[model samples]
Structures are given as structure tokens and as C-alpha cells.
Target: MTSRGPIVGRGRSVSRRTFLASAGVTVAAAAGMRGGPLAHAADAVPPQLTVAVIGDGRTGVWASLRAGAGGRNLEQDLGTRIIWQPGFTASLPVMEAVKAGAVDFTFATATAVVNAVPARVPIVPLAAYPLPADEVDFLVQANSAIRTAADLKGKKIAHQNGTTGTYSLIKYLESAGLRLSDVQAVSLSGADAFTAFAQGSIDGWIHWQPATALALTKLGDKARLLSDVKTYDYAFYVARGEVAVNYPQVLAKFMKIIRETQAYIFAHPAESVALWASQGGFPPNGTEQAVYEKLVRDARLSESTAVALKPVDEAAAASTQDLADNFHALGVLPNKVDVRSFLLGAQFDAAKQAVALALGA
Candidate 1:
């Protein structure tokens, strides 16, 4: 396997040298198009993989990858096309589309994924991405008396019930020796929660980053965070279970592309964020858009080093199962979910191996 070192790289493309150089790693024979053996498993590549995009789904890097991140077109490298289904409000809604086959893959929370299993959503986790615990905070009107989690008692707090936001809220309440019942927990989409909070419909919003960046920027002194929260949140790359079983090669290449992209981001945070803004990553470029961008950059890069994509494994299953059990215990979930049934670690072993071989690990 590549050295268990931090991802590091630079320049316009994330070619193999970037991996061996700054990342302190070596790679397999660079004998194919663009000096990458990404297409070794091309024969197994399907026509297209429909992806759910909240904000281009890291296309800033994927675009560069598709256009030739390593001196070759990644479409030719991976032998597939990406069909993005954009404007998803959140992962819970994305899971709905996944069930109807309108979407094939998405990055959702373990909370969302676990909830999917019980809802009969035909999706399983492809890999795990540990989320930054500090990315979420409680946003309340600045004039409100709620300065601490304890002050939130009896207040209406908006959180996306089945996603990481809810998990964070539950954890936050516990820190204050309280329960969900202690607060009027309102389940709402991110957008709605923001609107409602702005209009004073909700007492507080358990805001997530990027949106949190924007909320703080727009609300200015009108809103202040109740307190900083550290959450045990994780994001999962979930796909239709059949896809992982049938197209190991494609999934493997997808993982490689993401790893390379992550390296490139680490190497060129500015360029990556610039591309993000240009690609409508942070839209509306309002007068304060730059301010929002800066805040989001701090939020993202602060913990970007922790981003790693690996096949869902036993430890991952147990970790998420505990979170699932928490929801069930809180009475938010109808029944306990066996995270193993939906994480697909066993079924994804072949794809994981394919990824290892491609990276010359």
C-alpha cells in the first residue's frame, strides 16, 4: 500500500509523480495513457455512473480528472461517464432518488444511510469519510438568551432529523444533561431551516458548514453560535448494492480518482477553492461571497487532511451501528438498523483490492 502518510501534491495535474514525490509514496507501472494504469480494469467499466451532487460533488477536481488530471482523459482512464443529478437538498432526499433509481450514488451521512436501511432504501455504503467534528454549530439570533446548550431547553431547534445534523443536536443536548424532548426539535431541510431561522420561526438552527459560513456571513451580528460542538459524524459514499457487486473495477477507479483529487486539493488549496467558486461552488458571489468563501475555506481545509476513502469495513459497521442504535434509543428511528446490512464491507472487498492494485500498494 502507499505510505500511510499525509496526501501531498501540486501543479495543474495530479499525475503519479505527485504521489511519489510530496506524498512520500510510490506507484505501479505508469504504462498506460497519461502514464496511469487507471484503465487496467476498463473492460468492466459501465456506460455511466449517475451521481448525486450537493455542490458539483467535487467536480472541480473531478473535472480536472476527467479532462486529464494526469496527462490523460479520466473518462478514457476510468472508461465511464458521470451523470450528475444536481440540487439535492440533503442526503435524506438523495436516498429517496437512490431508491427510485434516479440516482446511483451519493455521499450521505451514516445517520442517513442507517435510516435508509430501515426505510427499505436499496443502497449500501461504498466507503467511509470521517467528518470534521467542528463543522457544525448551533446558530441562534444574537439577541436570544440561549448562549449555551443548556439555554436551548424549551427552545425550538431546527435539525435535519435523519442526517448528521440530528446526531449532532442530540449530542449537544446530552452535553447539557438534556434530551431531545427537552427542546422542541424541529425536523427541517437545511434550506428551510435557514429560512425559518432567519424569519424567527425557529429559535435556533444546528447549522452545517459552507451553509454555516454563509449563515454567519449573512446574518452578520444578527446571529451568533450558541456554542461550539464536536460531533462523531461520518459521511459515506453510498451506492446501489448491485453496483458494488457487479462493477468492482469502476468503483476502484472512482476511489483512486478521489484519492488523487484529495492529494491535489492538499497541494493547491487556493486553486481548488478558486475552481470551486468559479464552478458555482459558492454561488451568487454576493458582495460578501468572498467573505463566505474565506470562511468556508477555513472550515474545509482545517480538517481536509483527515479525508480518506476506504472500503467500508467491520470497524466502520460497528461505529455506525452504535450511532444507529442511538437514534433507535432516542425513539427517532422506528427500529434498530443492522449497519452491516447496509455498509456492504464484505461485498466491497474485491473493489478494495482492485483499488490497492491500481495504486501499486
Candidate 2:
């Protein structure tokens, strides 16, 4: 049943009732013949693992495609199906899923994980994609007279409250010698942020690609790149630490498929862009192409799965730490927690190694 390579789109259906019934029969048969506790424990292991995913944006779409593709490969390699649960909004919701035992794996940002760790949710990083600073942009209506970062003072701006968008805005404002208090922060998701910017409800919008590109196109001549926050790592894949430990082989196969897909993307940028566009439901008028080029040129996809905490990553970690610290100083985080210990873990290193080896890096 070995697959030739990773599958690259939405997964086929395997009804839960059917899968559970089969699993019950297999477990019963294994238990009847088991010779020891270890054997019994092995016999009790589930036949499939469930992974939760957020909505159908680029990240979610890519994740779903890779997981489905990878799961097929893994089923051949490990004799099991990887179930997926889709339609999540943010990492916080993913964290909620992990906490409730509804999902075994998902992706999130380092900062979000840090915020979650101190709450004792037990998650760990699986892999990282280092996004260079210029990959994310702060944008305003192109026709607006807001020429510099300083001009944002007293202006309303839209941003997702607890995401890279927020941090990017904070850093952009601070660098311009302005505090968040200097500008009105209008909290909005990437989608809503785009809408707000278009309606002129917000003078500026800070967001990542796809959404940024979409907004710019929607605004036509009304949108312009304000500041590119060239100092953040956009996102990372993560799993509940215990789930990863309990299912190393499953995680390994998943990483292998992701590595393959990443290689495919690098080798076939145009095709990859098309795939992203299709998955994300973007229009074919070159919007996806524009965003893909901007991101591909600036974002560094790992060539190897060596999730070593690179200096830049560490610096990003420190910057996030600083953000948390500032939040505490400003009474944002309810109670202060050790930001370092809250986010640091070894799962990323293991996942990195698995991906690197799979890709022959």
C-alpha cells in the first residue's frame, strides 16, 4: 500500500462509525491473543488519529492537502488512516481543540503557543517556517495621504488582536516613536480587516499575505504598502506533546509528507501557486500569483527539518517575549508567566529532524 509520494488536496472520507467498528473488531482480536501487558497495550492502540485544522485559507488549505496526501502515504506505511477535522478560526481555537482532546495536531504561532503553555495545555512545536520581515506588510488605502508610519497617529487601524498582525502593528508603531495609544487599534480578523479597510472604516490594515493582496486588489488604487514588518516568524505546526510522544510513527510520516510537499512547492512555484489559489478559493486574476511571489521570495521554507532554534528564531522568540513582557507591563496578560519556559520544547527539534531526513537534507 506504499504511496509514491504525498497527496496534495482535500482528503477522501472514511466514515467514523465504519472506522470505529473495524477498530473494535481488531482490538478484540488482538486482546484475545495478547501475551503480556505491553502486547495488550499495543492491541488497545487506536487504528486512526484525528487532526484538527482551521478554516480554508492558505495555511489551512495547504495543511489539509498535505495531511490528506501524507495520511494516505502513512496509511500504506503504518496501516492506519489519519482523520482530519477542519474549519477552525485561530490557533486559540486549535488550542481549545487540543485541550478538549478533539484534535491531536494542528499549526500555530510561537507566540500563541507561548501564551497557551503557561495555561498548562501541553502542546509542542512540530516544525517551523521562518518568515523574513518583509513578507508581512502594513497597508493603507493607496489614495490616502498617510505617507509615513508617523502619519498613523490618531488614525484607526484594523488588526487581528492576538496574531502576527498585532505584533507587527506594535513594532511598526513603536519604531515610528509612537505607542499603540497614539493610534486607534481596531481589532479584526484578516478577512474583516480587509473589509474594514475597503469601507474606509479603518485608515490602515496590518495583515499577512493573501488577505493583504486580496485587500489591495479590492481597493484597487486605494491601497498601498505602509510598512513591512521584517521581524517576525509567521507560523509553525504543533501537536499536543503527549499525542506526539504516543504516536511518533504517525508524526514521522506526517512530517515526511510535508517535507516532500515543500520540496514540490520550491521546484514548482507556479504550479504550487495554482494549488494554493485553488485550495484558498482565490480568484484567477493573478492575485494569488502576486502574493505567492512576495511570500516565496521573502519567506524561507526549511530545506531540512533541523528545527534548531536559529539565532533569528531565538531573536523572534525574544521579541515575542518582549511583547508579552510589555503586555504585562501594560496589564494585558492577566498574570505574568515565564515566557521562555512557556514556549520552549523539544518536539520542534524532533519534527525538524524527521522532515530534514525525509527530504534528504
Candidate 3:
């Protein structure tokens, strides 16, 4: 594995690197593409993977990887085509699509993954990206009298009803000896929540980074950080259980691509920020740069550390299980679910090994 360190921005540029070791392999390698040794076979053709992606531009790094620097097109080098199904900005809706098998894979919030299990979604977690506690928080008007979570009682709090934001808000309130009932929980999308807060329709808005950045930028002195929350918030990759069982190599290759892309992002911070800004519809200025830096800090992974892939570890599983427990108690989940049934760590490990051997990496 490459020994690239954590990706920090010092206003430096790095050359692009190919994700594949050799581009010489022929299309006949598809037989071995099912997580086995790459060997020649008859009647083989390249496979296409359909990925449901976020439309909000937060995941534009994946696009940069696919398109490559100077239009290198790494997906062609890997002998695969990616059909990107977009129009999603939040994890809850994305999870619903994946649960219905509308797409092959997606990266969803851990809260959505946990909630899906009880809803009988046949999905398995492939890997987890732990986010820093401050990535999500409560925002209030800069001049609002509500100074703490306690001040939220009897006041309107806005959040995307079934997202990690809501879960984080619940955790934040609980830590302050408050419950969901204490506040008038208003279910609103991130944009709507921001609008409501701006109009003083909502006392506070609980949301994630880029949205928070936009709010602070537009509202300026009107927006204030009322609560900085830290929770077991994770952005996790999940695939339909059938895919993990029957086509492990596809998932492994996808993981390898993401790992490589993550390393590249770390190596070229400025370029990455620009790419993300262009893709996510943010201005490539000091404000967006600051948010990107905060995202990197909260991600807390070096390039070397980012390459390690496990299906789901104990801590992640426990955190997700705890989410399920809390949601069940809060009457969010109709029935309790044993999260272990949906995790396929051992299988994912074998698949990764098989992919390494097949790719000769």
C-alpha cells in the first residue's frame, strides 16, 4: 500500500495517479471478477455498476475520480462503467432507494442504516467513515436569547425528521437533560430549516457542515452556533446483502477505487476543495475552504489510515445498535432490530483479500 500521509492543504499540487496497477487486462477477466483469481474465460464482457449518488455535490470527489485529471477516465482503465443515478441530497431517501434495490450501492448516514434494518431492508454495511462530533450541530439566530439546549424547551427546533440530524439533535438534547418532547420538533428539510430559522419561524436548526456554512455565510451575524454536538455519527457504505454475497469482487473494486480517491484528495487539498466546490455548488472562496478544512479535521484519517476496509467493526455496530435502541424507545422504529444480522464483516474481509490477489496489488 502507498504510504501517503494525512491530506492537509498547504496550497500545494500533486500529480494524478492511476487506481489500477495494470491496464493490460482484457475483458475476459469478468469470470474472475466475482472475487476470484483473474483468469481468462469465454463469453465475457465488462460489467457495469449502478451507483446512487448524492446530488448535493458533497460527493463530487467520486466524480473527480471517475473523470480523472485532464480527462484520464480511470473507470475505463479498470474495465468497468459506472452508471450514476443521482437526484438525492439526503441519506434517508437514498437508503429507501437502495432498500428497494433500485440501485446497487450508496453511502448512507449510520442512523438511516440502523433504521433500515428494522424496516426489513436487506442491506449490509461495507465500511464506515467516522465523523467528528462538531460536524453536525444546532444553529440559532446570533441575537437569539436561547443560549443553551435547555433554552430550547417550548421553542421550535427544526431538523430533517428521519435523518442523522434528528438523531444528533436528540442526543444533544438528552445530554442537556432535555427530551424531544421538550421542544416542538418541526420536521423540515435542511434548506427549509434554514429558511425557517432565517424568518424566525424556528428557534433553532440542527444540521450538518456545508449547510451550516451556507447559513452562517448568508445569515452572517444572525446565525450562531448554539450547540456543537458529537455523536457516533458515521457515513457508511452499504450494499444490498445479495450483492455482497454473490458479487463480492465488484464491491471490493469499488472500495479500492474509493480508497485511492480518498488518498488523492488528501494529497491535493486545494484541488479537492475546488473540485468539491464546483460539484457541490459552493463558491471556491475562504468560506468554503474553511468548511472543507473542518471536514478534513473531523474525518481524522490519514491517507494510509483511509485505505483500510472492514465491513463493520464492533464500535460501529454497537453505536448503530444503540441508535436502534434509542429510536425504538422514542417510537421512531416500529420494532426493535438486532443490527448484527445486517453486518457482513467476515465476508467483506475475504472479498477484499480476493480482490488484492486478483488485482496483484
Best lDDT goes to which candidate?
1
True-structure lDDT of candidate 1: 0.65
How high is the CA lDDT of each candidate model? 0.65, 0.57, 0.63
Candidate 2 collision pairs: 7-69, 54-88, 133-230, 133-231, 141-222, 142-222, 142-223, 305-352, 305-356
Q: List TM-scores for all candidates, in order.
A: 0.78, 0.73, 0.77
Choose 2 or 3, whichever is better by TM-score.
3
Error of 2 at 140 (Å): 1.2
Winner on TM-score (1 vs 3): 1
Stretches of candidate 3 above 4 Å error? 1-46, 56-59, 69-72, 277-280, 283-309, 344-361
lDDT of 2 by residue, 172-260 (tens): 87778987778888778888887677788888888765567656766778778865454464456666654443344456556655555
Clashing pairs in 3: 7-266, 142-222
Residue ranges of candidate 1 with Cα displaced over 4 Å = 1-42, 55-72, 283-306, 340-345, 356-361
lDDT of 1 at 217: 76
lDDT of 2 at 173: 79
